[model samples]
Target: MPLAALVLLLLTGTLVPINRKFRETPGGIPVFVASNGLHTDVVVPTQDARTGLDWRPLLTASGQPARPAAYPFVAFGWGNAGFYRSSRGGHTPGVGTTLRAALPSPTLLHVSWCAGPPQPGTRVAALRISAAQYEALAATIRASFQADSVGRFVPAVMLGYTAQDHFFEARGRYHVLRTCNDWTNRILRRAGLRAALKAPLAGSVLYQVQHVPKTRNH
Candidate 1:
């Protein structure tokens, strides 16, 4: 089974759907790539198909009454701290912000909880991976966060951009030349899946996984 994780690249709104063979595996659990035109996130089940991992502990709201399992999927992405935090409330960063993000800035891990399975289209695609592969991918995502002595992920002081998303401190620097897609591609390759050799744009990642057959879970 698996648990999941992402980065923001404020590039163009191009969505490429090229068929890539190294993107998925047959008869494996389903994961998804969710995009908002410019940036992309890797979405996974709250608890994997085998129930081998319960992500609730990591994403639990400290004082909320609702359980973490309420979310069907969790989309993870990474981005510059300023770009992520300031880009909230439908606000676009200014040239100053973009320039700062272009530098070696602190990073944050973005997590969005989905109510259901993602619908595949130009903006979304399914990628099937074996249980072992799922675990490896999840492990890389989990490692991005800064855990507390209590062992839970430490969320930013600010509220999520929306009701269903939150930002947490992460362990990378966001370079203007390196898009979030590069980070995700590394995760895919780490899991023994095929990914673009150079994924510096959101389209680079989406293009590779677009043709993967939709799994039953999707």
Candidate 2:
């Protein structure tokens, strides 16, 4: 395979959701269009039915549509980097300055992904959880774990196995975890959110350890 094609496949394949068909933006970037193919999957539309939270129709500063609905959590993993790259870089031309720049002023909550080591050149996928949904998810994590430490559970929840052949080929777990960390840190800084929210941050290293691959005991 050609080097550029190999790189593109690695970046997109690992990042794009596989259980559904994708629709590309005018910029030529592919997006997780809908939740299909996975027979028993849950489809949490970008527009929450009950609350009418339509994150799907969010528009960039330049008036370009930011298609958050294209990718659902059950299929596309929840890491911030993809969105950061897509919004900040010129990937979707005239989209916005960055995810932060495009957000409504006085932004209550924000998500971002930081470029790291390999840099991956440009980010490929992205999504945003509504304030209500973010709160609900945070509450669930707190209730289940008895702490509001979101950073801790991020890796295990977002990163996992995927059937792709590229940089993400056999690299889903670590890649996801790494992307999650990059995102968590960036958002915390951008929103001026404390490392520990509502409770003293605890068990951080243990949280990072979630990336360790498991093995059968001898």
Candidate 3:
């Protein structure tokens, strides 16, 4: 081969990847985003009245029949289980980053975005706790929020997953104010906890509000 041709061939081989990413729909979840050689899928567990275990097509907040959030968690689930990601075919995006329990009895799992870019003064924060620990955390949150009725629920637990990495960190680090809005936020603000962090975090925010009944029925 000519010298120039030989050099070009070597450069091409080095630049191109050996394998390309394909979409993966493990567990029957649908894929949402596909980019930079990555596949992501989000599944919200649902059950059919007759079938026992069936998947209801996921929908967006607007109720306009939209796909799940793409890439890094487009939205946060109320509890601690669901999130969205991009998809293409069968290959999923790499294990972006994840925060999970220490095994044997994992409680919570936090999937993460790439970590190199470094947010100004933040790092990914994931948490996992045992049943006891979760209960304890819930109680602490109720106390912190000064929830009207602590006994109404075993600490109305909710997970705040954010598409923006900063929001995720803030949710992990700040007080109830950072994690909640409206009445919940009002309760936290009145409790004297600031929203933005001034010092380091002592624990995660536990935001709870009384589920008062109005004239309308459930």
Give the winner by TM-score: 1
Write one digit per residue (lDDT tens) for candidate 3, span 73-130.
2311111111122121333334431221111211121223322221211122222222
Q: What ranking emerges by TM-score with the best candidate at the front?
A: 1, 2, 3
lDDT of each: 0.72, 0.25, 0.23
RMSD of 1: 7.2
Worst 10 residues of 2 by lDDT: 33-42
| Candidate 1 to truth, TM | 0.82
For residues 59-161, could you state the per-residue lDDT of candidate 1 as single tens digits? 7743422445567788899877887767877888788988887678888888888888799888887777878889998999999888878667878776777
Please identify model 3 stretches exceeding 4 Å from their true place.
1-122, 149-218
What is the TM-score of each predicted model, taking all chains together?
Answer: 0.82, 0.21, 0.18
Better of 1 and 2 by TM-score: 1
